[model samples]
Target: MVSFNKFLASVFLAVAYASSSIAAPRPAHSKFATHRARVVGRGLQVEAFHPPSTFQTFGEGIDHPLSKRTESTMEDSAVAFVGSQLKVDFNTIAVRSGFSGEAAKHVFLRQSHDSIPFANAVANVAFNHDDKVVAFGSSFVTPNSIASSSPAIPLEAAIATAEAALGGKFNQHPATLEYFVKQDGSVALTHVMQIQDGEAGIWFEAFVDAHSGELLSVTDFVAKASYQVLPIQKEMLTQGFEVLTDPQDMTASPAGWHNTGTTSATSTSTTAGNNAIAFKGTQSSVTTQSSNGLNFIFTQDPTQAPTVAANVDAARVNAFYLVNSIHDLTYKYGFTEAAFNFQQNNFGKGGAQNDRVTISVQSSAGIDNADFSTPPDGQSGAMRMFLWDFTSPMRDGALENDIVVHENTHGVTNRMTGGGTGRCLQTTEAGGMGEGWSDAMADWTEHNSSAVPDFVLGAYVENKASGIRTHPYSTNATVNPLRYSSIATLNEVHNIGEVWANMLHNVYAALVAAHGWSATARTDPTGPEGNIVFLHLFIDALALQPCNPTFVNARDAWIQADVNRYGGANKCILWNAFASRGLGVNAANFVDSSAVPAGC
Candidate 1:
């Protein structure tokens, strides 16, 4: 069988070079020209814009006695706020989703023209409890006239076109008519639908032109974790399993990992919990009696190659432990219900609940690979871990800590970046950063020192010292030669991700040097230590940055996060770290740059 890396490389290359025949949109006559805008990708699409808040009245009206702070009231207030800022009618703004958290009330809105929603034109607004706006990010476009408000082709034709493009029949969802904004600012009437091919492991949101039977665009939903297992700091078996009681964080998982309610009652007698549920293939769940208090101690035979029949229980328990552990660890770093994290219960926090991670150990879906599928906020994300045959005895990916952490991070980045829409990281650059973030997060969890060490992913499962990538993640220039310019020639997401991950490695080193180290950084969020600071910026920047951000955008968000949290104390350190890796102040369009900020 072909290796996972080779399979992905070929797929990405085909996608990069594929030709498109859709007509481009006309030049945008933006009405919000006076506002600050951030454009990304080759399309020069305005991914985010911040309009002046001089005319905002959300705070004034919210404080009045007549104004009730209900979900409808919040939606109306957000619509009025965005309408006034964007110079559009409030009727044209459709409320997509709204929820209230402890500190803020968030409302997601979509731009509409004549009651037809714009598929990609969206805005996210957050208001503090005092009714003052805290954050606003929008990709809404200026109003433009279209040739028609309805599709020329029938819904059947559109589905057929999508199936033809994917080369398979789809287990399709309901289709809706919407306005699609093209890269060049043109608009097309289209039928948009979510399509899934389970056997092929393909899930995509496809937009088919209604005027003409053409596929305008497709956003992939499957974020492949294509690397190798977790718990005990490193890959499993490398560090023998150790049992610890009550590992769940009270604030994150108040009901504990084994329960889904608000109390600490035992909910299951098997590897099922509030954060994750692990099972083998498509069979019944592996169960244990309550007599042992759910102790899942099983022996691994070192005499021969590993098989599913021999290590099923151990694999399920390890998978369950790793998922719950990562869930709690990340919650401390702000991947909570308010930020759209995975959990079966929200405990009255915000966001759509009833969505915990579903893990399949030793899955029969595929071989030599693992993947995670992220839908919207209320849907459960699925993680499939497969067995690898690279070594003498096959390796269970569920037994690898780095691999599990790597896959789980995909859910975190996807949900956080796009206001929990789970469609922002679809571009080549943005998707590459998703992979890079996964690798960087895995690397961070393994380190507890001031002196940074070289890290490699999937080393245990791949059975190679070099791991699965082209180069080891390192801060040294000679050790990892990848820089911003390296992406100019890189086609595969994993290869492109190396450059981004290495840049983060340098950032970690610089922060640790300036501050201090935290041995307990994984569970501790309070400190001036560099490790804690890195994680704070990492999670905060995901919410601050625009959807489909480039390297520069992500770097800017980190700097902004530091300024917001630390009062700009790490400005120079951050600039110097990014500058060393060719992502300096002057870096643009994947070009190498060495210049830092003028003050730095």
Candidate 2:
């Protein structure tokens, strides 16, 4: 397994080499000189590249550079285009971030001042594999609202104030001056500070009012916390055993445990050359191991629960396997080597280092939860699967395939959208949709697993009937009863997320209804050919949405993706699914997570 430090060094070297090969900005033709514009809110702007031959529709068929490139090169291209063609003052803007996914076909760039993203120029630009500037969605604004030239408080004083606001000692990353957008659409030049407490899995960003040194806002990046009982004649329910009869507590042989690993397809190229990686465990003890041969095992089970070791090990194995499998499957559709993937061992492909995902099995107990913090591509992010034995019906979350997959999906969704660097999906509505994606993906995984699998999640531990939710997801309104209106009253993201999940469920069911279910749905996520159409459109939608997207914007992106991919072939199916949940063509738009569309 490659170390994180080694991965960074390799990237830096590759970037250094690629820097010299940067091509001069291509001249924008007369037809492509003017960009197509879309109006956002009052005085806000949204624009995209709309040339004749270059700007193809949004799917994967368009040819991209298969040659190696770096995030820096991609950003340089975008900055150049915005500077020369758009004629924006490049000095006023700072390169907030630029990232590329291992399996993605493009590198994304976020433009803002300091480290605060989406502040001044809320630009999300993408460069295809060929190192040419391809697409963008920008709400660009010049730095016009700075109250003062210099900060009233110095950097050290601002750090101290933010630390006090945090209420605990935190190892702080370098703080930078950035612009912060207020609730009332005002922007303030502030000091943005990133704090990390690895022991607690806490990652947060603090925006300090530079003029007054007051902590303007603190965004907590710490996604909350997981266990095992593996897979069938399930005896050790915590280990996924299914005993024929409840012989009280009979111990059975742990042979052929499903938790060992599962197989998924992978690729190094954009073409048909694909391979499979069977994700399973290696010969490494949980405690001392930071990584396995094929995956990274960051934390191991403690000695306090000797019996829990086997369960934890198997759960970790399954978690790694599920993430790898999903990456491979998603890759086949459009997620190429350019999109980020979690892995310790790379196939020696170009620019494949430092993309390993950190996995913690049966993390420090007390919370029955799982989370995935998706940092930038090269940077490492950890997923904690905590043991859910805090109260009654003890539940081992690690062994739950749905829970593990759901958490991993968080990483995928976060990285894929918002410039491929964990932006967007931060607002309440976007967050709810993020949660919706996790639940929908988990439900889809299980629904296709067993011949008659229950769509509920965390059934054994969270809830037997609903499983961590009010009810199992259903297309029939009475069984679920969740819709866009549900978001109006239930403001919580998980609750509001159910509405979005139901919409996705109906879409999935409708797709299956159109194209019959294929037994290999796991390997082929799109049930069949027509089913793959929705998946293709859905993934493309992630790329189209701007940072901090609302439900309506998200809904439109999917529709537009269909227009780009199939030229509106499946628009009716997509529209019917969203409209069933009150997100119709004529439905009123609501940016608030607590406010749902009025028309059902």
Candidate 3:
């Protein structure tokens, strides 16, 4: 009943004051330093945007502060637009977004760059302002361009210039985000944006289910407020250096699965039941068990993945490692701390009723290679066959783990949500969220398979034909290979798998910083905390997200996710985590959402 903006305003006040700078971030076992807020990638290149003597809002730069309360300015247009474009609760959501969090976004940019209009965004109040919802938004800020007074240009010029202003390309692959209300009674959009300062941070922009506002990808930039913008980026003030400075108490640029776990298998004994066995091929002397269920046939694949034979108690032990790790971080959001019981058969065969948690392990050399195609712009591996019902015998191991975990995610997610396939897929041939969720579950599983370093994937190595890899996250659907990037457009769990990963991936980074996770293989047994953190969030996202398949649904799911996980009881904890770092989540903030969600 309280307005969302009021909630936002209230939330921001707490966020603004809370010191987000946590202990310096260092891998739990790093000799480089225990906790350092700054991280240098392989080649620490100089940036292009230089810091101003005083980073203040637009009006501040020119002797004015962002109009003290400019909420109404956006409200006039923002509200009318939402009313015209949306039918759901925008009447109040608009009022809340337009106000509670409106001034704060301008403040964030103003504090960093001269107050100017931020372009292309989507936001959620991090806190509630005076009962209104307060949130954050992101955008590419640019200084005013010099006058080109030859002749007056058309509005398209504004569109072109506006596009440039936000640091976006007109020819972007999926193009700008387009919001729509689907016939299925869903409101969502595709794509969004992240204000890049240059190479300091350039995660990737894979895709955005742009049509329905499902973010396929966007920037996973995290920075702290205390640390000022980079020092060298001078001429690039007008053009951000593509870097996201000052990630508050977290890894701004995290690297996952760059290599296999130093976990060597060549020396392990050919034990049938021990997970310690090096799984290089289907013929490994692993488990040789058969299914005992009337509906399921389990076996450690002697020929391929479906390696149900070797992974009996070992897989469950590994699962316990994962579930226990999650209990340490954010799953506190779960109303029911999900069941982690293990079984070889019918993991979700009976639908939502009989299934809540399922675990299956893939012990094949081929599948372990994480055959997820090369990333950046990949096309193959798992996300392709999302449509399959997954019932073959060999489908029992690695593939089984993937399918079971995913379907199980749905069953658990149904607790809070009424239950239905999340957003459909861009490709009709494959299952939508089911596939995405499955793949994501695998990613999560592999991330936590062991408490070892390199929370990477595909350590099992199912096939030798394809080179080794940790596994690519999502597929483009249009293409055969898979692609990895920020959350932008989302069609299904698989289509939007990247989005969920991006969110949880960073959450893991935060947990690493928060709990001071061990870094190196010696001190940090679990690699990055993100692997475990992501799993914790998965159980939570599924349970709390709207039972529908819409980006807005997911967007709302995220809000609830944050509240249930961090805010409320730990309001100070989660909010300071985002805002103190300059990350904004507000309407008209995602960049792509401008035309779609339209800042409402």
Ranking by TM-score: 1, 2, 3
Model 3 per-residue lDDT tens digits across residues 39-140:
122222111111111111111112112224545443443333333333323323322221121112111111111211111212222222222223222212
Residue-by-residue lDDT tens digits, candidate 2, 2-37: 333443344334334433332456322111112222
Q: What is the C-alpha lDDT of each candidate?
A: 0.71, 0.52, 0.26
lDDT of 1 at 124: 67
What's the CA error at residue 267 for candidate 1, in Å? 0.9
Per-residue alpha-carbon lDDT of model 1 for 1-600, expressed as tens digits?
A: 233344334434423332122234522212112111222111222222222111121221134221355554767777877887778888889987665643355677788888988777777665656665655667788644564886688888777766655544655556789887654456778888777765566676667678766566666667871001235476547766665666667777777777888555748666787788888755267535324565666655645555545477777777788888889888988888878989888887878888999898877778788888887787778788888988767888887878888898899999887678787776667778888999999888888457788998888787788888888898878989998888777655677678888999899999998898998877778889999999988987777665666787788778766765676789899999999999998987677789997889
Worst 10 residues of 3 by lDDT: 373-382
Best by lDDT: 1
Candidate 2 lands at a TM-score of: 0.67
Q: Flag regions of model 1 displaced more than 4 Å.
A: 1-90, 95-108, 124-137, 143-147, 151-157, 160-175, 225-232, 263-266, 287-291
List TM-scores for all candidates, in order.
0.82, 0.67, 0.31
Model 1 scores a C-alpha lDDT of: 0.71
Candidate 2 residues lying further than 4 Å off, grouped into runs, are 1-121, 125-136, 139-144, 147-152, 168-174, 184-186, 225-307, 334-337, 344-355, 390-393, 449-454, 524-531, 590-600
Which of the predicted structures, 2 or 3, would earn the higher TM-score when compared with the native? Answer: 2
True-structure lDDT of candidate 3: 0.26
